[model samples]
Target chain A: MRFIDDFRNAEHVKALAGSIERRAAQAGRPLRFMEVCGGHTMAIHRFGLPQLLPESVELLSGPGCPVCVTPTTYIDRAIELGRDGALLTTFGDLYRVPGSERSVEGASAAGLLEALVVYSPRDALRAAQDSHDREVVFLAIGFETTAPTVAATLLEAKRLGLRNFRVLSGHKTMPRALRALLEAPEVAIDGFILPGHVCTITGARPFTFIPDEFGVPCCVTGFEPADILASIEKLTELCGPGRRPALENAYRRAVRPDGNEKALALLERVMVPVDAQWRGIGHIPGSGLDLGPQWLEFRVEPPDPERPSAEYSACRCGDVLRGLIKPAECSLFGEVCTPDSPVGPCMVSSEGSCAAHFKYGSQTFTAGLAEIAENGKGY
Target chain B: MTEKTIKLGHGSGGSLTRALIEETLLRYFDSPLLAGLPDSAKVQLQGVPAAFTTDTYVVDPLFFPGGDIGKLAVYGTVNDLAVVGAIPRFISCALIIEEGLPQSDLRTILSSMRQAADHAGTEVVTGDTKVVPRGKADSIFINTAGIGAFRPESALPDAEMKAGDVVLVSGPIGDHGAAVLSAREGLNLDSAILSDCAPVTEVAQAILAGARRTSFLRDVTRGGLVTILNEAVGGAPLGLLLREQDIPVRPGVRSICELLGLDPFYLACEGRVAAVIDAESAPIVVEAVRRTPAGQDATIIGEATAEYAGEIVIETAFGTHRLVQMLSGEQLPRIC
Candidate 1:
């Protein structure tokens, strides 16, 4: 609480916000920026960053929320295993995310499956070791930042030779998603505020493509609003519609290009790139990582479509993921798709745009989103 | 190592001191009066009876994320009374000061305590102070008690939660835990992740105002919501059903929880509150709690019923279901 208290000098945030607004006016006609870290998305939402920013400078959330991007079939697969009588294990966020007709929480609450919510992969591995009778499957979902842990887990499982232990690998690579965002014709992003955590793992090199090929200003930023503003300044100042890639480290306090080599190496040994299926975006060709042959025992497959499933057809989560609309833009947003009764994956994940827009983005958050969706255009 | 034997310091009026009371003595001996024990003993009088309790905080890092020992001590007692249907009125304060704590830091903490107390609409009533040798204690330990007017419940262990009784949480989980984790370890992300450490009596009072057929109410602390769901109905006939997507957790908290390998369900949240009420009243109470700042993110996490015959299970996001058992050991120590 003390550390936060020190940071709460709100005047500083105001000063920073003012500076950003001022800087944006002189910088150009309009500036577009996106934060790749889910944490940054949350912080921006928590602090009301959008409302404070100048009208010309737009803050759009990218594919930062992991649960939002998680395909529905994966959840169905997880639910299937839970129904097939395996003890499902995952972080709490994954527990609430719906696959098709239900979530792991529903299965656990309904007594159809055993959901072991754990704090770490160590705990999942420990559960696999301690409970010989139960089938423990770790529902792995994250970016390259968290990819190494799964590597460590699989290697540990291999060492322990725990037969009951498996990982439903829904884990993704950050760079791939970023590339998909840039390549999309519908999206016209001017600058990128790269992910801090993911960069810490893959390093700034992975983002070199955004600068070299796409010619978009790429600045790896810290989580703070000031950090974001500072990164935005670098991005806008450096980004002059040129056909050259630029690599910048706005979060220099922590990130380096090579990143944690040990972590990267650990991931390299245990995993390899494979064609992954995105829920709303469809398959983005090698956008996901699959366990290597040695780790096949821990492999996960897409869930069966035949199982009992439920979905509120009106949820426009597909639009939200592709940067076509915000969460409130969905017709079912707060009415049918409140946090309690999520209609789509974005609504299901707490960090999703729908959740953010619904929870904090507006006096009536959905109004702006609906208008944007109605316009059928991207900024 | 069973944490069986108690030391002399266990009675030292610090956090571990209370842990001794809760973990060792209270575990084997919990009754209405004993269970009701808070910062101070409450004796009901005619006009407006109030509940009160005091706790001494000795967390290793005196302050982290959203609040500190002083703020936690204030909100803890206030929330305890509020959960039991009381309007927190005033609080008594005392400090067991470590001999060499910086005066400025102490002033800062005291000011924060005042601000938090003021924010909660409770005034500091009476107090005491004690100083000990430097190594004798952590940097600082705050002991505070709050009193609140008890609403005329006019009920008992009454109408035990039915099979369809809904379980509700005041707001998102793991704010305090993630905030503390980041602050304690100096893990910098893009933005500041602060603790959700504050009182919720005003919101709790609102939920209680709209009386419904309720069996029990408890704030998920120490063990998180998972622990509360496990203990909701002591009897063998009660069943607790939870829809995974219904539960809310801040995305950052979830990601950090994933990164650190922690469970937000088991993570500590000072501002989050939970209660077992009639299924119909959950949304009503959620709406009521939403009126307060702390309860803005309130949601109905699950329901309690006479189904499982006596166990807690959570469905995974992947669609499978499993049991959510009580934490046998500490997940993250000194996170309050």
Candidate 2:
């Protein structure tokens, strides 16, 4: 608790909160800041940061949850691989995610497929090594923070000449998605709180475009109460009238301007950028990662296009992810799309904004009900 | 449409498990005792109040740091009975052994069970065993059923729980979960954490003997403290407000949870007990609990509240609050 307890100091958080309130008052307008990372989303809600910030300072969620953004087609492909007698492996976030037809968890539970949840890509590689007679396909999905590990695992597989190991990549880059969000007609985010973990790999340099081109102040943020509050304070200070938009690094403790070079090099050697489809958001060109030519032998085939995919037109995840509305504002947020029977990936993935809202921020919606019940009109 | 089959989450002791019980199992077994679904069933035998509980251990590796499956089986059942205000006196063990299991491993497990039973002051009055083919079972699976006489002076009824009641935890949590996970061969890190798989009988007994009014008591096990607390306020028009800083968690467990993107609140603990007592007697109960060896870390974690009914809200260090929902499924590691 050395580093953790220190960052969560109440005194520091209170000071930062007071500073943010002062800065927002000086700005003389309602400030809308978007935190473009699932970790930030969870941390903000987990610590109930909104209660600390002034009502004028509204925080919006962006397309930062990797599992939420992963296209259902990718999951369909993994299920196909499992159905073809291959052992499917993936992160637990993707286990219950409803694909086009059925999720990997559903397929496995029905005895139609064999699947396992691996904490890391190397665990999937180990499964491949352990099961020599069968093919092991890792349902690779994540952002840059997780891609390097998958890249390293592929390199290791190549070094050992493991033939049965395969990967279906759904990895995506973050900075480009931010660019798309800014360019969207409906989104009016005044500033951005960058993802700390992804920035640790890609560094703060990739996100400079948000401020330099879009004139929105951005800060690379950490996932602590004080860290987030400090970032908010910094972004608010920079957003003052007559102040030029700039990028800041409040998470310098773990991130660098240049990022982890070794990981960048790993991505360069074994992976390449490609056009990929985001689940709620539509296609974003050159926003995805795939195995490079040298590692193509380890790649799994694309999903079958003919597979019947369920349409979730009623899900307002796209609007929620785009910062146009809060999760509670979505009609199907609680009663219709609870975590147990999620109507969209946003409700299924733990880091998704809806899941975070439902789990940690539902007091806003339920407080009224509780008040009514306390008035003696029993629920 | 998703197929209806027994998924792994059904055994996770979370929402899916509750659904399986309410939607399926309860349909066949409709008795009120089973319907209430307390850790142990309360009944009267020969006009004497008693508690009965059973648990099965299928923890992989069979053995882990600081404890093994055998000890877990005995302690798990005894703690269930103990928390229900009963004096654990008799337990029965049943084993389903894989054919290829080594004799030494079996001996080690059985001997640990015997030692655990003796330490808890309970007797294995009757038992059964069966050998299955190699693939039929894991290395070994142990099931234990216990019986205990109700302590008339310390009968903490569920209906007695109300707003303003204080909640106290016996010790740090998540050690058992972290230790078992570390014992597996993956995510490559050498951990020194040990499973807190000892008996919570002392802690439970201490609280009961000290508290002027004890309303509810539960052994924090499979679903951890959050799940237990959620169950405490499930149907009641009450909520719990927990101080995040007050919850005791070991540094090692916290580090492991951080690395894996897991919440320590949802992690399992085998040797901890959470009790809901009258607000006036909380300090006295904490003092009494600290007198026990296993309860040295005891502290008041939270208190029931009339606001935010049917929810558990945790107040953070920054004076902000959030709702702590019952875990929908297993606490899986997140992908960054």
Candidate 3:
């Protein structure tokens, strides 16, 4: 009980909450803050951190969730495999996501799905070997933190000569998304709460450009409230009066500025950069990873595309991802688009700024947070 | 239409997607629930309801072992309202479709949603739809808002937990999350693994028959039963205890989690709940669930303690004690 309770030093959060309010009050201006990890989005929502903060301090979501940013084509390809009797495997979080008109779960219910919700690609390889009679297609989706595991899976699959397996990859890099996000027209982001897991894999080099080029402060923090508070303090220091943007690491317990060399090495060996489309953000150059030509044997063709009879309009999700508008401000927020029938990418992913705000009431304290964090889902 | 490779626009809510929804969606889920042309539905509530419950589903791969998004949505909303002793009546489905998606698949998914709604005895009633540019959306995303009827005598309180109560689960723990994880993560265990995403209204009503002995009831969603248990027992004068062996887990789920270095307790569960019953009526309450289809797999997993008020502990297989914390973020693909 003590160990379980130790993880939550709620009292510290309470104290920090008071201090943050005091600091924001003294500044008398709306304080802008962004939590750059999808996990943080969920944590803040789950813990109701937005409710805990003062009206002047605005907490915004950034482009963080890999699942949220992954393009529909990758999912459609995975869904196609599921429809074709191929045993499609992926993270469980993807199972409920609707592909076009339905999700992998809906696809499975109709006898057109072989989607398995997996924890790692290593498990996918093992499944391929076990189900020797059927093809196990791994739907690889993640940022750099998870790509190495896919690499290891492929190496092991080849080592064992598993002939009944293939992969549909949409693994992406983090730096590109961050750069694109900074240029989005939705909100004027003052600072960033960099992802801790991605940093553990790619290191600080990928993010240094943010501060150097954009003049915005970025802090890498752990999931704990203390870690988040410490990161916030670091942001205030870098962005305060006469302060310039900079990169600071608050998660020193695990993340090193240099990152894991061996993981990066594996990534370079197995994959290469490809022009990828994010679910909300448009085509970001060199933002995604694809299997090297040598690794083509690991990939199989995906499902057929269902082209819209007419040109589709801008979903507004792109604007939302870039912090363009509040979910309610959107034409199709709660009125026409609930999670059951999401119309844009922002509502599709739980970590998406619009979806997070819609699911949990985060707009209550956001008013006094003027010009600081203006948009919930900006383009 | 000749078979061709799928493009991202299929999910977009344009002409092609409309074809899928109209042609295929109307075929199965042709009911009033999914027929709505608005973002959200406005219902009369049929005479002033006391509580409002909204839930959203964003499972990846969208489809997995047992059920797909269609059934998951229906059951998810039904279970959400049912946990509070409400019989889910009216519901709405909101969809976000990625552009360049296929029509054939949409038809398939809509049909499945209809089937799930039929099984759960709920109506779709109203829904919304939107289309994003090709890269602006995933295949599809569904959010469900359900309004239901809760009997005045059977209201489930948010913070009504008390001490000396017994905790009961409808069925095996972690199977739904683990099954999904195995299929998604590709752990590939020899054992068959399927998600437990059934509607539990029947079982819930059975428990409510003796609701007087119950202090609090909550569905084990998102963060799972440990999360609910932690929240239920915490800030109260009682502690909860569970015998690890008493918590049922399937062979494939255990193997998948063990192989992946994950724990089964933190995974999501769609068709289960943790009901705190008076210690004397625990067995009778368990029997009530045993008689129902959804609760046939139910078991008494833990009990509340007077000591260490507001903490959950599990007696491990090693005869040692360890505390169970609420899931921090998401257990991700580990669900069975």
Candidates in order, TM-scores: namely 0.57, 0.96, 0.57
The interface RMSD for candidate 1 is: 17.2
Which runs in model 3 stand beyond 4 Å of their true positions? A1-7, A26-28, A83-85, A185-187, A301-314, A364-379, B1-336
Q: Candidate 1: how many backbone clashes?
A: 48
With candidate 3 superimposed using the best TM-score fit, by how many Å does residue B177's alpha carbon deviate from the native?
9.2
For candidate 3, the per-residue lDDT at B240 reads 88
**CA displacement after TM-score superposition, residue A55 of candidate 3 (Å):** 2.3
Calculate DockQ per candidate and list them: 0.03, 0.75, 0.10
* Error in Å for residue B3 of model 1: 43
Cα lDDT tens digits, model 1, B1-336, are: 112333322432323445566777788887566673433345566755656666666665778877887788888777777776667789888988889889998898888888888988889989888899988978888888778775565332224677777777888887887888787656787667787888887667766665477666666666677766655644457767676668887778876775564667778778877777787767777788888888887778777655444656454332334445444334421100
Report how far off residue A111 is in candidate 1 (Å): 0.7
Clashes of each: 48, 0, 104
Better of 1 and 2 by TM-score: 2
lDDT of 3 by residue, B1-336 (tens): 223323232342223344455766588875464453222222335576533356666676677888887778888888877776677777788888888768776777788888878888888999999888887777887888777776766645333555667788888877777877777655567887888888888877878775456676767765566766765765677778788778977766777665653567777788887788777777777888899887888888778886445667665432334445554334444221
| Global lDDT of model 2 | 0.86
Q: Can you write out model 2's per-residue Cα lDDT over B271-318, one digit (the tens) per residue? A: 999888889878888988888877889999999988867778898888
lDDT of 3 by residue, A72-181 (tens): 66666677777778898878666656555566666665666666766678778878888987989988878888888888888888888888989887777889988888
